[model samples]
Target: MNIVNEIISSLKKIQESNEITVPSIKNKLTFSQIHCIAAIEYIEDANITKLSQELGMTTGAITKMCKKLLNEGYVWKYQKEGNNKEMYYNLTELGLGVCKIHKKVHEKSYNKKKAIISQYNNEEKVTILRFLNDMNSIIEDTFSEVVENYTGSDD
Candidate 1:
């Protein structure tokens, strides 16, 4: 139980440490912007609708975010050879640089977690995995409930 509490505190710190500064981006990238950049990098032919679906945001919301990303040189939007009406977005060189930095940070963090898990035996690892999955499910349910109940005001 004590170890579990300690782990929870440490994980909170780890989560906070995810913010990394990219010298070129100039503007501080929010969590959403980082994810949006990563998604564009991962998906070829990423259009507004596709990104909106992937990010669970409306196309209008995505368009607004992408506008900022484009103005900041983090992304580029263009149409395909025959597609004038639809536009696709991709990471620019600077965006790719930031993504690489972000990826390395994530990989290092996960690698540390994996190393810690390796200390446990197979049975313990299985138990830990199951516990994590169950906790994640509970968190998802709780988050949905919170969103549903939110009034967005103190009064």
Candidate 2:
């Protein structure tokens, strides 16, 4: 197959693998909800501002998600001793349980893919890695140019 077709096929396989592994954990939560939870798990005691930046969401959206999580008993928010206006959030027992399940699913998917890739010979592995790296670099460069043009400045 040609390079473009090969790239498309690889991306499709990646999407399929992610779907297979993600549905179990995602069934109990919306994609955005699960992403918020996972982001919180990564940075414990994060406030709304931090969550908004990390999740690429607006503070208002994060606040709504936080409220739902709190109401569902999956997370709790508390004010710091010296900062009553700034509240921090952490996952409760239920949230941690979900995080653990998500972690397990990710690990399983990684291991399964790794096992299959390991069967490839050293030369084949090197070629695959090189192609992936080159593709990533090309994508990054193209997007950077586009963003610079849109912003009217390059940093």
RMSD of each: 3.5, 4.7
Give stretches of model 1 more than 4 Å off. 1-8, 14-18, 151-155
Query: Among these predicted structures, which one has the highest TM-score?
Result: 1
Clashing pairs for model 1 are none
Q: Model-by-model lDDT, in order?
A: 0.86, 0.81
Q: State candidate 1's TM-score.
A: 0.75
User: Least accurate stretch of 10 residues (summed lDDT) in model 1?
Assistant: 146-155
Model 2, position 110: C-alpha lDDT score: 100
